[model samples]
Target: MSSPPEQHSGQGKTSDRASSGKMAPNATNAVSFFNSTAFDTRVNALINEWHVPGLSLTLVHQQELHSKAFGFATLEPPRNCTPDTLFDIASASKSTTAGAVALLVDDEENYPHVQWDTTMSKLLPDDFVMAGDSYTNNVTVEDVLSHRSGLPSHDDFYFSKRSSHPDDPRTVTRNLRNLPISVPIRTKEQYNNSLYTVASYLVEKLSNKSFEEFLHERIWKPLGMSSTNLQPDKTREVGLGDRMSKPYIWKEESRRFQVLEYEQTPEAQGAGSVWTSSKDYALWVKAIMNKEAPINDEIYKGLTRPRIFSNPEDDDLDPFCSWQGYAAGLESYFYRGHQIIQHDGLISGFSSVHFFFPEFKVGGVFLGNSENAGTVGSGILVKEIIDEILEIPESDRTDWNARQHKQNDEYEESKKESQEKLRKELSANDDGLAEPLKLPLDVYVGEYWNIGYKEMVVQIKDERLYIDASDRTMAFALDLEHISNNTYFLGTIYDMLADGEEVDKIKVEFRFDANNRPVRMGIDQEASLDGQLILYDRVEESSGQGQQKVVVR
Candidate 1:
């Protein structure tokens, strides 16, 4: 691997004060720390170890923004990643959605009916209905934005190709009624992207503009974030495709990074679709930190105010963070006596994190085009910077790189053990018979339909059964490896799209009627909802073609 080259903005001059254990709270001091050889070595080491193709870092100190870029953005043509390179911010877009809603709430003269407490049903009565009657009637903008709406993240219902649902915000919001509510209202903070989509839909209803337009007019334009947009294709349209960082995933078996196709999620506009460059995102973070225009005091407070525990159980385990809570769109973490308001975004092959210290008026943004960027790489760099700023003794500073390596090793080991256990279970036959499947493979091949997750087609090819989506994108297909009787292991194909290591090998079970005919297929798409299976009933043939066995070979 080639060494990552550095590109600095040169906004702040390097100071010799960085050599001390702690630097004074100033932009120059912060720049000095960032420019120091020690910091550069640590960052390069982390990037090389994590196999990150490209990384963009932006720092905020004393209201000044400093940014730098490292590594190759595109490997095939050998293009260097610059600070202007655009990357998908993923779930980090949630904060912007919340900010847009806050802008609407501030417009009391025009949108008097729109408030944080205003029920979603009142905003979009025709489309924003929940599963439960009470939830449908009472859920508020705050409830959905804070993720306390009692809905588990039914992400697969929308992201999975099996669902031929329309890629519009209103339609997605309307489909929420068909999903199951896994918890009671306001009891737990379950992160549901669907609710964020509903929030985006609410933005559309109130502003009388598309979510993208609202963001551009209110937030992006005002903040001078010209590079920020809601779609990747927009980058290509504007003749900046070469500046867009290609997404990549680390393949453990091959010990190399593999590129992946851009995950186009027009439906997840508010949840995770914002794409921008480090240069543009720095202005955004700086605005939030300095209470700049468009992000007024009320908006900032609404965006950062802690409403519920994000993960109360894990509070005691972290050495740096004492408490953590989920705010409207952002997250609050009390790290080492400073309140850090932040959020992290992760999608297929992109990860990003933006965080700031309210007390110190310091913040940082890390955007990388690889899976480990936000999960492991960003955390290490952020903590290291925080330690330097806070004047923590070098001996007391935790070895985040080592800590992350150990944790990652343990996680990979556990994943391997689980996969082995699943393999053994799938191979075992209860009756000890050579024929594991109770019915012929042809009998199980048919079209299954569900209201929330449209149609799934099972077919036979090369004498083996396979399941695929009707509106398949990226050519998604899974093999039906027979486990025993009616159950089969959904084996995903090892392709460029699938990282292989994290592929969800969910089980599929076929339900047969009294006459021993397959009637329904049960799949645990929403595994977070207590393992409840989303049943897809068989789609019977039309009357004209009735009683004809369909086979695809």
Candidate 2:
């Protein structure tokens, strides 16, 4: 269903298409490589190998934009993707969020008090409270934006059921007090989406406008990225719905890609939710690289300043780089001796990678409709392009495809071994006697409450136990299978989000009161904390009428 590859080139003031018709030798070589037949063939091969339905690739060289698209945007309807086709750039939106905040920080006339060092307690004292007093009082806006706020990624807290104020950013920021802090304040980089939500809330408070509105007035409009928006629905509202790429996830069992629903919630707006096209995203990156408006020297410095090491123990030792670090919404690293500033975004079925070489004034943006497209597809192809531009010797070039394939195989094998070990453990019994439950299955059917996760309901359907968060749609529901005595495995609850082997690892244990009544439930939600379970108490009814003598821990 895919059409032939399409290419678009835009002329800039300093472009090779200028009146002089002159280009740097390196730029000329790069342009030739991008337009060559071999490059198109290579792109097609990568897309086919990775099973990516569609891909939009845009490059900025010599201040001009070169964009290309390949494959179908949607398989069933069969729409070929174009340079203007929009895809959810996921966490890549974080850079924009940081840029928006930087604009506010730089605008002394409008926001005199707002700065990178401004504490959240000072900004939103009532809403932004961390677990510890030190964290609650001293954590700054920079700390949160750079992901050094000491908060663990309690992603399920927002993604679970519809809480009291599910769509409200303030509610999300206020709930941070209930969650646990995994590390010490400013000790290490702990990527947390909730912190960005708090940052969005700060933007709202400072600007007296919604985060989306602020972004439009300041960042998007100035960069001429008209197609870029905060929420997915806006894409439809702007009459660009036809060009929006349908999200897809690779199903290993079926050896096919399955379509995934759009994430409609706005609570995590500042974290990872931006819809954009190759053309529009390239402009945004170009603006950043060219030191255009809204990206002044101070703003760019704040955006690219390395704050914390993302992975101190990353021993990959790839010849291309020396070190990597997190810088606000962007990540910075040495790629072939040139400082590369970039960010990768992956949410559900969409993936994107956008990076710029500040030294070379060259950049690349890749938007794809499959889950691992950014990591496997663009992540590999972009490096190959870089090698070509740098004129790296063929003998010295690293086989990134082989390296990635080997890593994927290793991960799959490890997961298979882990699943096998779990199955064996679950099937094994030290004693000959059966480990039957003392209480009936009905005793576990009840509502459980936790401050962090809100409410979870246990129900019996078709003679089998099932668990789901209250007010959540069926998409968040999970079937509960008894493992032993009082513990049950929440089947595949996070398999799609995390490792598939986690299906067997996520076990819920029911606790009993002195009278043998189930009173609470415990689940290992925070994988960062080894063997630590998040406890939820069972909700008891005041009246005896229609009350079941059941308890859920």
Candidate 3:
């Protein structure tokens, strides 16, 4: 649980131990409106209830700044969170990516020919094809950055816990031609991580530096973000790792948050992968909020300007909000007669939200160290702070905290119920089929290949069949359970098709030739361009050389 907030008086640099609920003005243009007792109690309760290990918050109104840290950065060793504690900000780093791109666009010396409207074909590798529709040939940088690139949300194609090619964005980018376009180019919004990875590569191409180096030399150093770094290597080099908050995932079986081992995967490069502190991030917020010189003024303007009409579905959470629209990196909506621009990000075990009112000059940064804390806990915290800053009527501030908490509870309960049903179904049907194995386990052991997804290997080990599906990012070995005849089921794994809704087991089948020898195998997984089952043919030997052929069904 979070300790009480250590209050600092506005006038002097001394700490105040008084339990007075009052407002005071600082010597500068800032003031503290939060009643310390009430604020501390509410935030601590939220953290404990949501199972968040730690969080850091920063609020900027006019020139006044307020920062608060709570709970333990890591529950194991037990380190209290401070303003300088680091957390993975996740996709909130998108704004930074967009900002860097916009800054490069405005720079004439380095990239004189590049612009937001520049065709992606001209900027990317000449061999990079958009496949299928001819309209895709006209796609530009703006289309991808604004989520209007007509691509579906196929994160599995590039990122997962088991990806073998972690550092190669080109592995996914080169395969984009094999995936079908979901919508007309620039017609609708569809969130895609593939395009962002491609965009980050483009930055490397244009700047002649690695994406991490570009961010460090150009943005981080300029803004004096000492506590921020793009990759774990730099973070460790600077000794910031000791102060970093370890990521945690809520395990339903354990009924508690468990520490997830962190991996420096390249798949998160362009879309997420930023680790920094709330205090350090507040510098970024202040720069954008004030619209400072060098890079902030122009980059902030370009990023905040609406490029698409997309709006978050949760706009009703604030009754006073008007229409919401998405910009390149930020989203804009009217709230209580003021234009509010914000964005939220979620990674494996961390979440963050950043927003600032351009007109009102009020901005807030929220970081949480749990899966539920970022979306649920940060949402409530930000709304309450906004209300306090605006001084909304007591009755007008509907109990949004309770409503969001209830939603979180419902989501968890629903997942538990679904998993229970799947467990029972799998347990009831674990017997050998009537028809038996078609051609023995040896016939099914071979390397399967796909153009989009590289390879999956099936092998028999310890008298049982198991599949090494690392190519699809399913890192662990899947044990094949006999169902009926040639068919077997991969039990318990969640489906990416239904957004983790359905746990319907995956079915695998082996096909045999006229001579009763295995020719190919099929699996009920989406790996084809047309969203069909993937097929892998036998690896035939050609002149003492082994070659595997990909067959899409």
TM-score of each: 0.89, 0.89, 0.80
Off by over 4 Å in 2: 1-28, 159-165, 418-438, 461-464, 469-475, 488-491, 494-504, 544-553
In candidate 2, the residue pairs with backbone N, CA or C atoms under 3 Å apart (3 or more residues apart, or in different chains) clash, namely 518-551, 520-552, 520-553, 521-553
lDDT of the structure predicted as candidate 2 = 0.75
The CA root-mean-square deviation of candidate 3, after full C-alpha superposition on the true structure, stands at 6.3
Range of the 10 consecutive residues with the lowest summed lDDT in candidate 2: 9-18
Please write out the lDDT profile of model 1 over residues 1-553, one tens digit for every residue: 2333443232222221112233335434456687776666666667777878778877777556667767767766667777788999988889898888888888889998988888989889879888899999988889999999898887656643234444667778998898888888888889988788888888888778998899989899998888888878776787777789888887666666677777666777789888898768878888888799988898888888888887876623457776678998899887687787889998767899988877777787788888788865456877777777777898998988877777789877977776566556555543323235666888988788777766678899776678754233223456667766566554544332544333546656777788888888877667567758888888865446456533221
Of 1 and 3, the candidate ranking higher by TM-score: 1
Ranking by lDDT: 2, 1, 3
Report RMSD (Å) for each prediction in the order shown.
Answer: 4.6, 4.3, 6.3
Give the local distance difference test score of model 1: 0.75
Worst 10 residues of 3 by lDDT: 9-18
Which segments of candidate 1 are over 4 A away from where they belong? 1-29, 159-165, 417-435, 461-464, 470-477, 488-496, 499-502, 545-553
